[model samples]
Structure formats: structure tokens, C-alpha cells
Target: IEHSIYQIMKEDSLLYCLPKEPLQQAFRTNKLSVQGTVYGYVGWIFCQHFLERLGKEYLFLIHILDRRNPVGEEVLEKLKKRLHQDTFTREYILDIRKQYPSLLKVLYAHFLTGHYVNQAEASNQPTISYKRLTAMERLPGEDLAKRIKEVTTNYHERLVFEGFLCFNKHVLKTNLYQTTKVALSIRMDPSFLDEIEYPRDPYGLFLVYGSEFRRFHIRFSDVCRGGIRWIRSREREGQSINVR
Candidate 1:
């Protein structure tokens, strides 16, 4: 599992997406925080390779989104064994309901108020709204909230990790934005790309990687005063002619 994931990272240009100067500054200041969601082996593998490349004593925090499931438990055991005696790491394997009550409340209020969504849309960048949150369910806000509440109470639904991550993106940008240098997610929904608006001043980087048929492709975008500018590799078709 580890080897396969490492190969994917290598082939997919994971390191290329990161800006070198900001990364080095992060390491020097010792304020680097790498946060991501882990469902199974692949997520953990990405974390391992990421830390190895960072090449220093850094902190890693991962949320084990599937702690209750059998597969989740299996991976947890393997991860514990692999990361044994690692000092600069912390793992959270709690139920989502108990883990983030305050955050949930804030999200609930956002849904009802739609203040953030309006703000984002007026700025031409939409915040994560009820439409984005229930994109999978295709349900109304009231219904979706009820379903999420059920999951919170019973903890039977399989969307535990997905729900938490979707909701947490808002907090990452607002509450935790200053401290968070880099945030990554694996196999995220394509719609999420539009929702993320990385701050230009503080230099926060968000990377999302997705794989199809064992091959990985990445898209890089940054915000400019005009709009979002896409940075593509020169290897892309019809671009080499202009490389000189």
C-alpha cells in the first residue's frame, strides 16, 4: 500500500504544487501544520510521504474518519505500528458528533443565515453553502441537516468523514486560517475546487489530489486581483512551442 501510494505521489507532481519559499519558511518558523482526512490506507500513505519529503521535525495531525468501521480499525492498527514512537504527531479517532460540537453549531448557523454564502458569491467566489454541502444528497437544507443530525446521534452513516471535511473547510479558512499553512485532501469532489479561495497575503496552500484508473492529475490555481489564474505545466499540449 505504501509503495503504491508513493509511486502515485511521485508521478502526480505532489511536491511541484508546493511553493519552495513558503515551505522553507514554514519549517524555519516551526509553525507548519499538515492536516488531512484519512479513511483508509491511501490517506495514511500520503501523510507518510508528505512528512518524509518535508525532512524535518514537523507536526502532523490526521483525522481517522472511519474509526468505527472494521476497515478503519484495521488501518488504524497498521498506522499505529508504522508511526510508532513518532513524537510530533497526534491522531483523532473520535465520533464526529462529539469531536466538534462548536463547529457543527457554526455550520448550522451558516446554513440558516446564508451570510457567508452571500458574501462569497458577491465576491465572485462562493463559500461552502447548503447546495455544496448537500450536493451528494441533493436534498434541501432542513432535510440534510436532519440526516446529518441523525448521523451525529446514531453514527451509522458512511458519510461521517465526508460530512466533517466538507463542513470543516469553512473553519479552516476562517478560524484556523492564520495558523494553517497547508491543507490537503485526497480524492475530493471536483466541486470543492471552486469553493477554495486561498489567502494571498498569508500564503496558505491547499492541495487536492484525485486518481482515476491508477493515474493522477493535478490542477493548480491561485487568486489574482482580476480572478483565478491557472498555472499549468509546460508539458501540456501546445504549450512547449511558447516555452522559449
Candidate 2:
């Protein structure tokens, strides 16, 4: 009886939420007003029904986290060091090590060494070029490591790392609204945003829950690239329009 019960529980655990057909259709057509199989409302309704079948205990499966915080430089350094020393399976390690090539011998060595020398020349640094074939000439893995060490030791690189860290954290959160909000916040970067142009519209809504039955107005600009006025109606002809 115990073994049979365990099998039943395991089978139940295998059940997964079905793909929201309406949401998939919206992405396919890039339109919001489609009904019947295309209406996301039906998918949402089905989700509510599924949740009821699972009972209130199913709420424990939800994950909660704030994802905007950036990881420190110390954290990145530690992770990099750990990754460099990683030794799990021999096959995986060999696959990665094969990606790095040491400076070759003979004429090939001189040719490959010039690639690095040319970079120094472009940067106005003292340059070395070899025209002769020699077996001794080789750039060690340490040379590549040194170059990366110098490249990443900068304020701009640190800023970019911070942005990447925040993005990674946001992806782990796995909530649609939180992911969108974090991405919108990061787009405020001036370096790239200034050269690009985009439209704006005022889109707003509120998600209400809990005992107080309170209201929280949400501004689309706060959670998206800009305000986009979605012209939604029961009529088929209505198309979404927006202001810039």
C-alpha cells in the first residue's frame, strides 16, 4: 500500500501547467484583441481552475525575491576564481581547455605572436614584431590571463559587470512583472539610450489583492520602455495607438 501511494504521488508531481495558448497566440500575431482560442482570458481562467484542483497547499511552490541589487566586485572575483579552478568531469574540462591555444612553434609562432603585438601597436604601446621562424617563441596561457586582467580592471567594466549581474538576478526571479520592471529600470543608461529613439504613451493599471482591498496605480512607464496606449475594444476594428 505504501509503495502504491508513493507511485501515485510521484505521478501527480509530474503534472505541469499547460502552455497558455492565448499568450502564445498573442506573441505569434502581435495583436491583443483576438478572442476564442486566441483570448488569453480563457488560459487565465483555466489556470484558476487548475489551482483550485491543487488546493491551498500548492501556494508553497511560489518563489519570492527582489532582483534589482547588483553583486559586488568581490563576489565576481570569487566566482571567476572558482570557475577557473573547476574540475568536475574530465571530458568537460578537456572540452574547455581545448578552446585555448598556446603560441605555436616555428613560423606559425611568429605569425600568431604578431596578432597580440599588433594590438599593442594600435594602443600606442611599445610593439614587437618577429619576421623569423623560431620554435622558442610562444605566448603562454598566463599572457591571455594577464590581458583579461588588465582589460577588466576599469570603472566602465565594473559598471557593465554590475548591469550583467542585475540582469542575471532578474532572470532567476522568474516573475513577468518583476522582470519587465527591472529591464525598464536598466534602460535608463545614458550612453546607448541617447542615440536611439522610441515612442511613448501613458499605460496604467493596478493589481489589487489582500484583505484591505486597496488600490495601487501602476504607470506603464515605470515598468516598460514608455507609456503605450493599447486601444482595446469589443469591436474587431479597434487597433492600438500610442504617443511618443
Candidate 3:
């Protein structure tokens, strides 16, 4: 079956809530990873009830088990019963295992070391680190803008890179000073490399809207440079920055 990423994510949303303790327990004892893991179907059922009683604010979390988790045969049995034969949830977890083997491997390490996976630290690690990868820090305000500019420039120059085109920055104008807004704008391109069959960033222009004196505008620039657009004018008071 052809399943979209959104569909898979919808079925898998509940898996996010599994706690570190049960995960650790299952892994430590070499039990089936899903044993202590919450049932996806149960979570789904509870969410329906919760949505009526509580609202979207309250949600459920579930965890998928692998060999690395501290789950044993008994834990797996309890989960199977709770899942109540929801093939979709089972299939989703199975897909996660196949697609993200590294996640399971990392969980195993956590089980062995009795440590919860540290997302903050792990994300911080540089893609091209010389030494062991360390936690990457949040991109600072200026740093994000600078990175976007760099990416735009590279795309302008037609560099061999991915995600460069999607990178962007918005320059905000305020009474105090000009500020920055960073966001990624990813889209598929029709052009493709003949042999490689890879899509290239298309030629497009950026149109910025908002204030200049107060620095209240979003800056737009092309990922792959060919055309450029600018509107450096301001709108009247109490009115939104016009798009031109």
C-alpha cells in the first residue's frame, strides 16, 4: 500500500509518550521492547475519550519496543492484549524499526548504560565533526540568519548541496532595531539532473513585505539566484506591510 508520511505519523503519534523508566526496564532485562510499551490502539481510544472530555491539549504517548529495550516476553504479552489487534499500530512500529535501525541501536546503548537518549546533545553534534560528535547548540539569532544567507549564496552559485534552497531569512523592522526571522521553504523542482535524476532549485525571486523604518518585514530571497525582487517601501500606520 502507498502510505504518505502524514498517515504514518498520525498512527505513530501516541508512541511519543513512553517514559524512560519502562524503556530502561525492558532493555535492561532483555525483554521484548514492546512489553512495557503502551499499546497504540489503547492510546488512540483514550485520545478519543480525552478529546471529548479534555480537548486537544491533552494527548497520549506510546513507545515502540526493540531488542534494545528492557522488555521481556511477559511485557510484550501485556502490550499485545492492550493493542487489541490494531494491525495499523503494529505495522507502524514495525516500519519504524526497519526505517530507523539507528534509533533502536541508540536505545540499546541507553539500556546498556542506563541513560536516556539525550536529544538535545545528539542534535547538537555536527554532521562533519572531527572528534566524537557532541550535542549541537541551538543556532543563535544572528547565526541562523548568517547560515541562511550562506545557503542562499551557495544556491546562487549552483553548489552541489541539499537543503540550501529551502533555507531563508526574514528581516524584521522594529522601532528599536531591525530583527531577523528564519524559516525553511522546501518544495520540489521540475528540473532534474539528467543522469543523477536529482531535482535542482528553480530560478525564482524573493518578495519582502513589512516595515523598513521599524524593521517589521519578512525578507525574501531566492535559493538559486537568477531573479531578484525588492520592495523597500513602508505602509501607513495601523496597516499591515503591503506586498508588492
Best-matching candidate per TM-score: 1
Per-residue alpha-carbon lDDT of model 3 for 1-244, expressed as tens digits?
A: 2223322332233233322222344345544233112222222222221112211222121234343555654565555434333322323333333332232333222222221222223345422111111222234335434544454333312221111111211111111101112211112222321221113432332222121211112123343333224445454621321210
lDDT of each: 0.33, 0.27, 0.27
lDDT for each residue of candidate 2 in 112-179, tens digit (9 for 90 to 100): 34322222223443322222223235444445334334545454332222222222222211111121
TM-score ranking, best first: 1, 3, 2
Tell how far residue 89 is off in model 3, in angstroms.
Answer: 2.0
Worst 10 residues of 1 by lDDT: 32-41
Query: What are the models' TM-scores?
Result: 0.20, 0.15, 0.16
Tell me, by lDDT, which candidate is best: 1
Candidate 2 segments exceeding 4 Å error: 1-151, 172-244
lDDT of 2: 0.27
What value does the lDDT take at residue 192 in candidate 2?
Answer: 18
